[model samples]
Target: MTDRTLTVITHVDDPSIGVLEAAAADNSWSMTMVAPFRGDPLPGVADLDALVVLGGPQSAYEVQDHPYLSDEIAYLREAHAHEVPVLALCLGSQLLADALGGRSRPGDNGLECGFIDVTATDPESLLNGTFFSFHSDSADPPPDAEVLARSDRYLQAWRTGRSTAVQFHPELDGPGIEALLALEGAKLRQFGVDVDAIRESIPTSGPQPGRRLLDTWLDDVPVRDPAHH
Candidate 1:
């Protein structure tokens, strides 16, 4: 087994997969993608160094509509119980919050689409600057979770123990964002999101800075020894 293998759980096909693949390549880490649609789970989740849960179109409350969500939540809860380092984005964040006793509900401000600025609550944490957000629902974090950032749209980011969840897409780069716009242009237009405006908002750069932030957060996390648990 590789010393630094990360398990990624995602629903459907996301344009940001290339970004994540590149990040893993840079880190010299092995990754195994587990798509819920394919009915696959981590073989030995406890042996993983990190867990990454990606965004999905469905809300956390729609477990009845999507049976895989129940299984996914269970797996996430198990990972949390073991103190695994988990980074959840968008709908995955909402699921992580719900799995940790938080409540996921319809966002009061409706859908938070396009690019938005997130104010950092804990500058010492992983998320310290602006991020890309696209979601229709928000979450009320559990007591165990710490609010790390906020935006006008919804709870931008939160953390509980070793697990960190963000309502934004820090893993997305310029090209990835463009691919998403192309794929969901019609939907975005329906929401009154101007394609040019969204394109202008995306920073024309890489994700090294954001990856460094994530690495910092990982450094602060206490690595788990199998014997301890």
Candidate 2:
């Protein structure tokens, strides 16, 4: 029998997560991708068994610049209301925060690009080790959210109902690292980001953490049963 379907939402092409695909395969699940950057229409909650929102370069609060983000947030809120499971990263996580009455913005400590280690609130957290980080913003969970982890500066992971969100990019691999460099390296350098350190951290960070995250999500999170093939 075929497994359940997981809907993946991407704001940009560069942040496509191979780990998500692999984990879906391992879990006997199928994946469908929706790209707002490419003008893809957002899928309804009924069309998904689970939802995953990937990282992007845009800030979550910039609804004016990225109008689709508002719709995305609305959809997420709807999904949550219906008890659908969600796993969101970086910008996606920020959006999730907004949907849940929380918020995110650029931090005073500067950009959190590259790999970083975090403190987990429990043993089952996906934030249990060093993972990829590539954003300037951090999320503040809602009053009822279960904060699973925290970075030195802000919240790293949280959950509310069936949804889980993380401020780090645990979905990135080598190609993803290269894609970020090719797309934003010069700009990041001009912003005083350490390209050398980010590059050095790449080898150590690898795709394992991302895969582990995907695996953990599949294992721990609640999902509707897979339909027959």
Candidate 3:
């Protein structure tokens, strides 16, 4: 008998999760990517091992503009119902929360771009650490979900069942962060952000800790049923 390589499906809203791709490879997981924003179809969760939803510039409430946001929410809801482990970041987190009876809306405190330190509810949580952030919206996770971490300004991480969600971008390295900033340059400038200052604050130890956090998810999150692969 041969062991089948686990397959992880990633929904890419932006192509900045290289760190996550690397970590998935390290764990010998093969990837299947779907980009609903680009009109790609989402796959059924029953055959997959895990689902990873990456951050995006779109708001969770903008279904009229980006109709695919509705599709993603429905898809994630299905995945959760089947007990598939989901790893959602930033915009992805908001969508997951909404699918599971939570609400996502414009951040009352405004955009949180750049590196920020988050407090972990558990002192030794892998979700703890300074992570790169970029979001103008926030999510209040489902009423039954366990809150894992938070910053002084916003909710950072939460988990329910086999799924996990984090508002920060642990998948981005320095260049990746720069690329995201460039995408949102005009908005940042409009908000009086010093683009150069945020550039200087990019942490050298970014990708390493991010990978470790991912490793924890893969190793620790309980799987209900073995995937077909």
Q: Using Cα atoms with residue i matched to residue i, what is each candidate's TM-score against the true structure?
A: 0.90, 0.90, 0.89
Off by over 4 Å in 2: 204-207, 221-229
> Could you give candidate 3's per-residue lDDT for residues 10-117 as a string of tens digits?
445558777877777777666767778778777767766677888876889899998999998998898888888888988889999999989999998887877788
Quick one: best lDDT, which candidate?
2
Q: Which residue segments of model 3 deviate by more than 4 Å? A: 1-14, 205-207, 221-229
Model 3 is weakest, by summed lDDT over 10 consecutive residues, at: 1-10
User: What is candidate 1's local distance difference test score?
Assistant: 0.77
The Cα error of candidate 2 at residue 114, in Å, is: 1.1
Residue 127 of candidate 2: its Cα lDDT? 72
lDDT (Cα, 0-100) at 171 in candidate 2: 72
Task: Score candidate 2 by TM-score against the native.
Answer: 0.90
lDDT of 2 by residue, 1-229 (tens): 4478888998876455766777888888888889886889987676578899988878998999989999899988998887788998888999998998998777777877777888899977657888778777877787799989987866788999989998887777666776787688898898888887877767645356778777878776555644510
Candidate 1: where are CA atoms >4 Å away?
Answer: 123-126, 206-209, 218-224
